[model samples]
Target: MLNPVMNNTKWYELRLQMCALVPPPTWSTFSTAGYRSQPDREWFYHFREGGYEDILHVDIQVETPVEREIVRSALKAVHVPGEETPSGFRVFGYLHDGQGAGYI
Candidate 1:
């Protein structure tokens, strides 16, 4: 069996950078009321799962109204260029994925 793999190591870097924007304290209710931020592997799959070829698409779901601005600022602070969307931001970059080396 083959496992999904992100070909670009930069994506990993970007994930960490972006994840840092959201402090650990607020991570409990960052996304939505019941949704927790999976700092480890959450953001990485957005591009591959959504079929986005040239951008890092992240959907920010806020538990409160104030989180909107926080998310906006974080999106701009990310390393790559990104545009705000209704649900989140579309970070312009190359985030491709493919099957990892299959088991012998």
Candidate 2:
């Protein structure tokens, strides 16, 4: 009987290929109603109250699993104490490499 072995090369290659296929992250923006700006430049609002505004822009980068996990944990630790408004939260990913460089 022959045993089937999982080829991690194909998996890794596919992951790399898929990652390559995706366009690099770019700037984006969103607007919210009933949003309050703090002196520290943090905006507070609810997730459902406002729609994403095209005017507020940010650069978004594709995140790796470790990065995503770290961000998720960080978000969990953050505390926002104040009135919440809809459509408040801008998530952006950071890429260490693959920026301004030509792909093969």
Q: Assess every candidate by TM-score.
A: 0.38, 0.24
Per-residue accuracy of model 2 over 1-104 as CA lDDT, tens digit each: 21212133422332233233333222133222223332221122221124333112222223465444433333334321111112222332121243221111
Candidates in order have lDDT scores of 0.40, 0.27
Best model number under TM-score: 1
How many steric overlaps are in each model, in order?
1, 10
What TM-score would candidate 2 get against the native?
0.24
lDDT of 1 by residue, 1-72 (tens): 222222355455545555665441121112212233353334534423433333323334444445656665
lDDT of the structure predicted as candidate 1: 0.40
lDDT of 2: 0.27
